[model samples]
Target: MTKKDDIVQGEGTKSGGLSRRGFLGATALAGIGGATGLGSLVMTRESFAAAAEEARNNYVVHPGELDEYYGFWSGGHSGEVRVMGVPSMRELMRIPVFNVDSATGWGITNESKDVLGHDNTFLNGDAHHPHVSMTDGRYDGKYLFINDKANTRVARIRLDIMKCDKITTVPNVQAIHGLRLQKVPKTNYVFCNAEYVIPHPNEGSDMENMENHFTMFNAIDAETMEVAFQVIVDGNLDNTDADYTGRYACSTCYNSEKALDLAGTMRNDRDWAVVFHIERIEKAVKDGSYKTIGDSKVPVLDGRKGSDFTRYIPVPKNPHGLNTSPDGKYFMAAGKLSPTVTIIAIDKLDDLFAGNLNEERDVVVGEPELGLGPLHTTFDGRGNAYTTLFIDSQVAKWNIEDAIRHYNGEQVDYLRQKLDVHYQPGHNHASLTESRDADGKWLVVLSKFSKDRFLPVGPLHPENDQLIDISGEEMKLVHDGPTFAEPHDCILVRRDQIQTKKIYERDDPFFASAREQAEKDGITLEADNKVIRDGNKVRVYMTSIAPQFMLTEFKVKQGDEVTVYVTNLDTIEDVTHGFCMVNHGVSMEISPQQTASVTFTADKPGVHWYYCNWFCHALHMEMVGRMLVEKA
Candidate 1:
């Protein structure tokens, strides 16, 4: 191999030494080469210049300006959801879902504990995917759902207040990894995939039986946060996606061999992308054609090998992510072990389900070779696809129509530009790619290993979330954001698509219970500053206007159970208040025009003071209240 070929292959190669740079060079290059030259040669120096200049204008969000797109990222090990501004890559907010945050008093507050169950639940979560709600293939922005791969749970956050309102644990399933929302008609269902296989009941009765071990495909009611049904499919599930028509939802099933060993799981030459008939499954649930398994009352349907509710399409080795194209034409299943992506036509799926198509391969329209370890695929509305080549550490940009033409035995070159990433990249998403209006303006590359990308902060390094301007013909990497731990997956939507309220509503359902408590005790939360004693419990009803609390002092007996409720009556925006009791492990947010409460035992209390932690007015430091704990 030549020096150029050596440099390319030294990185990685697949399907007979086929490197994207070398392939593009041998196909389109006479002499021009390298990153800059390849850009100019492909799109011509003049057009490339215009595209490059426009890309520079995409990222620079000046002071007092808002971003054009909102990015919802899954905080992998941290067990939270992070919202960042697209193009700018600036972290806007962190919505604590399954994780414990002492700063915002997420786990300490009674309001938060109501959402997070008070039972034997641990404060840990491994969030994998975050998908926004949709309406008829468009972002409705009502809610955002995220899956906890660590704890078999899913949590939904309200878009208006940007707080987690509900969290539901998926019974009879472990490791809820892949997650997606419905598309057409509305996102009525939130689909979650069970990654690990465990025997039902897990009572050690069938300890060594591999056949009894299987995972499930779960569909959750988006509004109720309840498990609607579970479909038992073949093998372990990895990633999943829904179609625009809302008739089908497909998941990539690895370990089709159903073996306990790692080598046995990868023994198959090809795995299956199991597609579920949503309408038929709904019918089965309605007709009571399912059975309850273990302690979970969730209706479980057998969609394994020969079930009519699901059809297993044989795909290349170890299929990973199942992504539907924006135009609703094809479903691209990335080959995690192989170097190609199998494109299955969505229109032919109806024929396969109707038994008109004899073979499962009849649904496959194209199997174009992209690069080594093609894990996930995203689309640009202009009939092009950008796939994350994991082993190759590159993003392959290819025309979808050209790939279909090339897969049809044409000699056309479907390979476009392949840009090198920092390290191993995983899931990459384009702007509005999940909705009908996939404008394809920007792309976010989530690189798993950020080696040498940022300053080394000890052994554990941050992930590299790179932003690319896909508005032009060539994809240009604009910014590199050093993210916390790992952000597994993310989705981008237009900023205008999401409508957030500046201040919390007084009648918001998030704190409706707290409001009801004040009404039960004949206390006006908006103006009352009353303290009532009931047995060994003290109810401190307080209000905050701006710089001072309405109840400046309240006396309670030591060793008494105290429930302090603080209501912020400020009607202005950005006047969020926080109640933090000194040395009491208590802190909670009370947004403007909102009421929040926290419960704690006054065991070792002397004269503990509570203050507003969030900055508000000039006398913010004066916003303190004393809790005088008398000797019991």
Candidate 2:
């Protein structure tokens, strides 16, 4: 096995022979094989800072230190949500959501265009699956949500000022992809997953009737971001999961031959994994039995084929990640073109939704082949199960009840260690592996092509993530990093379950509509500075503190409609402050006791310069301010 480990385990199969499906079509064109021993399993040099200070699964922080976990990434297509820190992966904060941020003027603030939708009018976004927001199944540091597979939308954020407060737009879905929440009574649902299959009145009258194209399974309203019912199901939802007695949830439904291309979605060798049954889709949405399509008033129901709240099951090739298993007993399902990982048995999903199981693959109970391209799975609360594979760039680590005692034939080996990851890994997460407190330390992976690992930065390649340690019994690779844009997925949380907030408490329902329009124009954003014109519409009102900006100058006029607002007044929690109006692309961010707004329209008359882009102290470029404008 050492001809560069047979070209990194596959030049279309050799080492152990037989992989079939033409070795996944030679692992979908597996080229780029480099293996410089994945840089000796990431030990950078000099005993890699003494094996990261004798490993406690620490990634080392220093400089006023702090970071025991908080990750929450997704930022894919950079629609934004970053916030890292776990085992020192650093990155700290991004949030923006559905694009347009320029330092913090998220979509150029008017309180983020009243939460990105006074007609969101698209600024570009993609952000896939971020999560966080759970309760009895853990992590509840308030909210996180995410997912905007480029505008099928679903924002949320607000885990105590991490920002993004609410976006919604899930009407009948189109590519909301897969999102998850509701792990028991507390989360009250967020679900999601619409991934293509249009024409339900998508207006174009079923062009050639692609099986009347479908897609739906939404469910928002984890505190009113609305749309609380959708279901529809049958295939074409990608990755989603939930289980901990909130009556189930789970997705993975590859093209199920709704066929549109890519060889008619691999013409099924089995493609399913639905599940659903959240109290019978909430008693078929409180007995209205469900319908309403175009002009979505939510309630869709009909969990496809024999629905009474779905079951589907099938699964093999084409199923792509639908995890679960954190001692809530199993739901695995990877198998993107098969290497296997079915698993199933969450107490046999109440005996396969009570039709007394016996097939629906008998609520699955383990399939296990695990290799080649098993797409995604994670969990470690001791019964293992890492699984990333993606055409064998590796991360297997098996063992769920010894792969159900080797699928019940009991010769039990369950393949444990695979490691390698550097090229094409698509999602692998561990710490708190999907709730029930799954603390198996750390394990990130992500990959999806980082070409030569780092420092080429040209043909667009910066996604290597890595970071392992999986708390012993082997799986080391501790930290490789790189990441940018294609963040696609990430979640760790446990900086004592993230309780954040050292400032911004004053009237904060996140700037409570800019403190209810500065209490209807009498303006007292804590000692307001004042401007307030109101005809061509002005309203200035500044404040700050570090290195000034309590007005300093503010005029308006030329085609008015200004706005401004500011208000940091430094309560000293990292004294934040930033306003940037220069050449008017208008910026924002005023943290401390916070209050922000932005408007922008003096339509360019003169003396713009507003400054203070967040630095905060020692005359930080003299914080500055000017805005004048008058000349209409």
Candidate 3:
């Protein structure tokens, strides 16, 4: 055989024919040529420039211009809110909210429980609807509000630290889906609604012949971020979707009288967009005509006592989203099973609320057909509304100018242009301005499935977020961000407008005081690690020191109430520890020099072990303790 043939076939020794280095060099040259040639190859200067431009746009971030806007996205069942930078399309941070995130020791940390706190009955949650605080209807960038549907709670995340500050439970509510911030008409309360039907307040009713009421909407205070008042409604309040506050507080309702069968599907004819006259409820509160219920003493509005506080505007299919215009002249709603978006004039609602129109029927204005399964609508300040089509995986841009014209009886159809997205899209939100107007520069489309769009990530595919450039006439797909878990909803605010801090003060009581100084200040940091038993109440102050828990064992009797106060003795920064008791639904974090506590009832007798879940030191696994509970 020839020398080249022998070398290629590996029939010749390295010394007899081609050396290893020479063979590798020859193969690399041939491989490069073959790669460039391909089956049929073509390259041009224009093509090269276009390719280079696309790469630069996708990866490059100019200095001093970090990010134009910040998009707060819900992490769904992952129980967190993902903070992403727009334009750059970079994930800035993941703020843990309604779940036990072991990576950051969020729920595992003791002090973090003040934020992760919820009913012991629920260990996790489906976090949805990340609504930022508004000032005069504009994104204030101070506080962000998100709802936990699974746990039935609302959490307030302070933007300064990018951490959850407080989590308030919604008593007697099955699921919380609709959450929105309202600042207009002089009230600054975050509106939260129960998505599912439950029995009337204090009724002790069951599913069989249960009196279905919409229940009270817990209006959480903006400053304190607590559930302040509840606006109770009387009806078979089915699932409520995206809500807004403009001329009146409005929410889209699904499957009340129009039950979508046993499978809980969407119906095209029975859904509605309901408006609540919040002022009437405020008057009821002023007149002291409200009743309190449950341990929280949540005020409930007697549906039988007041004039009708709710007005229903019947729309097609299951309306999943509602968005008011920047001018507050109109509000748009799209149904999940319908092909159209119903646009209602705010003035018509005022007329209805004034009792000028009949209250027996739903107020219908205009139903402009957009696309199949239109799920959400967000307006651009440029007089256009973008609606996401879930089934079609496309976003339809409709003209609100034409919608208003059509409402004025001028024959103008509203659907303008439809842009294609990656997969099944859920919710789409646009960047807002001072007047709560959509900036029209960028629109984020959250899609559900990502079968072949990204790398094959096994059975559980990464969620796809399509960043679209809507600055020009045509919507251009700018970038694709692969995200973990399902992102249900998102809201955008300017990055420069909001402020965030990286570290807490070293002397701050909750997160910063030194362990030695705190103990000296008389906060009860006893080294003996005593479990004080007062009758059935057991109090244990557990301290952390590097590789071991100071209190290694907790001896308690069953049916005893146990309150464990956890304290961290570490003086070093970022050396936080977490505490989690298995199967007891107790988890919390203790920062350096800080103390946090968790309380639970030791109802069953068994030997249970608790450990530090935070991955800090090398001997983190060794920081464990045991709880021995004897039968009562």
Candidate 4:
């Protein structure tokens, strides 16, 4: 056939001709079907150019080009921090913190058990808020702190190493929901707020009467991660929502004193924003009298009783988010139960405290109605704020100054625009621009549901993170990323600002680099995995290689406290090993050529299998040993 005839076959063409039917047959032979079997259809140049532009916009990556921004999101109920690349919306890493990770053997090795801080009371974690380290009121890219809602602890993840280096489990605190790292004026502390109220240390008070009481942990020594002190917040303090650290130094002079807390109740019990004066609270802790809840004495900060120092301002119903502008002139909060985003003048707070203005009369400075169920609010350096609406599944952009002026009878437009997200959106993080002159460009909306948005794997669906472009006049929904677990909040920073460490030195204490140190610590690779029994304590020292644990069997009494020290024999990085004692609630990571230890009381007498969880070799599944505990 002629070439022109073969190229433009219409109807009644011969066999093997380039007609529509022949093209369809060819595509069928190549296994192309359904909507994708459109090779037979002709496309216009304009349509092709549009499709090519979309493909280019959604391009995964260049050969060696790094992402422009880094996103650190909280892995709720997973007890880990998920790291992703912005604009690209690609998941890069998952740092195990306060959780059991079989991939990296976290909490499954001796060293990681210490990192997990497991005790007689077995517990997992639900990470809620992930806050990036800030310096001078902006992301410093040095560390990220996340709070475990289930276990009531805080983990400090070193950005350089991309791993959790420190975990501070506070005593006498329960349901820690909010964590804020103070950095604007260089106050080295992380403020953690508890949701539910518990009795003072060693007290068994009735929860009904104690519902008004709350505890806040003062995690000092940010460089070292330590709980310097604990303070009592006496009020009908609802589940504390997000906190904001003001940029300007207040009367207290320290940046920590000006921390504003959104005292919100999930049950919509009260509507008040509590302004904490850290300096006064610190003084009360130094010379404050204790009050007895039931039997234990707690330093309760009751402003009515002159025991604490905190001022309250009435806001809308059920405020879920609170943030300060870049200039520290205004504080914004979103009421999930109400559609309005309330903006409170920071300077007017002093008037409210001085009794010049009453909450019922003049509490709210500016209340601009936005959308249904606003949960979080983030700022771009330019007088604008973006808030997430859960019920509406959208983000509303508004001008902070316009909201303030609207309340002053200027009749200005506070809401600039709104962009729809997939499913139910929860919290959001904008590109780092929480400064007076920052030009907020992008926003990542963390949603709660992703039904029918991606391929279904099981009953539990992955959450969706929608990337929105806000550089133009109107907000644009650009991309959708699927996240497996429930993500609560995220923090974004420029890629160039981050400096991560590729690997840790072999001699690190968490992963002993030298055999001499392991030997000096009584952890030896003796033949048969020597077990030392002394009274109620039993210690086993063994070494691990690929697909095998040198000591395959262990025996202990039901009441005995068992300590297993496992060392990795391999010298290559990433060829790590893990020890997980099934049903005993014991796990640890033994890094390559490193040693780690895990200790637990074998209170139950049963047969258990301990295995390597790092997936190091083909026979990694068989790298298990028998563990038996007999009745004492």
Best by lDDT: 1
**Residue-wise lDDT of candidate 2 within 1-632, one digit each (tens)?**
12221222212232435344433423322321122122233222234345444664355678788878888889898788888887878897778878887888888888888888766789998888888887889887888888888678888988877888888888866778788887875788888888887867777665778777788888888888898888877668888888898988888888888887799899779988888888878887898888888776778877897877888888788888888988888888898788888988878788777888567888787798867788889988998889888876878777798788778897656665565667779888998888999889898888878776578967777888878877876576767888886886898988888787898888678779988988998789889798888789988888878888878887877998888888887888887888898887888888888888888688878787878988888888987878778788
Model 3: per-residue Cα lDDT over 497-568, one tens digit each:
687654444354344322443354344663546677779988777788787799899899999988787767
Global lDDT of model 3? 0.69
- Each prediction's Cα RMSD? 4.1, 19.1, 12.4, 11.7
Flag clash pairs in model 4: 108-587, 108-588, 109-587, 109-588, 109-589, 110-597, 110-598, 160-501, 381-438, 506-513
- Tell me the whole-model lDDT of each prediction, alpha carbons only: 0.86, 0.79, 0.69, 0.65
Candidate 3, run of 10 with poorest lDDT: 38-47
Better of 1 and 2 by lDDT: 1
Residues 305-340, candidate 1: write the lDDT tens digits.
889999999998989989999999988999989989
User: At residue 445, what lDDT does model 4 achieve?
Assistant: 89
Query: Which numbered prediction scores highest in TM-score against the true structure?
Result: 1
